[model samples]
Target: MSDWGPVFVAVVLFILLTPGLLVQIPGKGRFIEFGNFQTSGASILVHSIIYFALMCIFLLAIGIHMYIGSYFFLNATVTPLASSSKSSENHFRQALLTFSNSKPTNTSFLSLTQIGKETTPSDRRGCCGVVFVEKWLLQRQDWRGQKMADWAPVLIGVVLFVLLQPGLLFQLPGHNRQLEFGSMKTNGKAIAIHTLIFFAIYAILILALHVHIYTG
Candidate 1:
């Protein structure tokens, strides 16, 4: 996919997922709130989270992953050859163990400080690969390595949204105890359902297109 592909997808998601993106008043579609309705911070939080999850899913579907640090730029310009998505080097976790597996071992766990003090930088260099731990290995870009990467941000959003409820935290101007979009007054339930539907459609469309953010 082109560099602008991800950017375009991001913009499309923002428009579709943003609540009250289009608002109209004094028109045929104008809506009126029947109750002392208002959207709490919790509602907004939920919507935000839903948007995030959908974005991740969409990106994953399109093979768009965020490279850490300067990896993306360096890999693009510096690396002569693209690194394999798989790492074929020794396990970094084993190196961290700092113990023998074939012999008897101590059960005691080392503190972070002790580990930090014991850990020394590797003097090893790579031919064309990046040195992870002490070995020249490829960066992992496969789905297996990032199975739960989506959960971290989603969980944070979920927790905040849940707390936003009951008390209706962070009452802003537009959502002042009521939720309405354009001429259509809405509740959290409706918003949540529509968000899910939007996600489904976007996901299907992305799958149909089979777009990838990067090659190799």
Candidate 2:
């Protein structure tokens, strides 16, 4: 299969997974809450189950779409590519290029950092290829004016995961209080691990289905 489809899906998933991107860091100025409709632990557990179930259904749909839309079903069994790395690299390069060419709306918070700094465009591409090795792998992207620590993305992921869990909701000292939903607070490790596992499983399932569909 081509890289674009996988790249597109990865980007979509990233957006879906990181709803906290808009949120401000703990304390710089006014803080913004990330999510809405905070629920009890029981409600959250149920929601989690439902969320995962729907994700499975979505994966099934993707497999079916691949089989029907691609030449895989009609042709003899062919081994699927071992990974999505090439596709990911290409897309990241494209992203950097887009960031480079576009006029900056926010000079303070560009979408990509180190654009004109460290390396030339060609060298940057080479280095960035290593950095963005996988879709879920978090190398810092610009988030407002804040300089996210290396583990910041992981923390954001963890925080979001915690918020989704059953919890005694405390009114966090931020912009919003009376209404539940507070600013983003996450555990970096949890999010990183979750992303790695989720994407690994997803890639495996996709490859398996790709091979199985063609072989059968």
Question: What's the CA error at residue 119 for candidate 2, in Å?
Answer: 72
RMSD of each: 16.2, 21.1
Q: Candidate 2 lDDT, tens digit per residue, 96-178?
A: 55544443211212232232333444544443422222111122233343323232222222333434321223323223332
The runs of at least 3 residues in candidate 1 whose Cα sits more than 4 Å from the true structure, single-residue gaps closed, are: 1-18, 23-53, 67-69, 72-150, 160-167, 172-216
lDDT score, residue 133, model 2?
20
- Candidate 1: worst-modelled 10 consecutive residues by lDDT: 71-80
Off by over 4 Å in 2: 1-44, 56-189, 205-216
lDDT of 1 by residue, 140-205 (tens): 234334332223223332333333222232222223444433322344454454445444443444
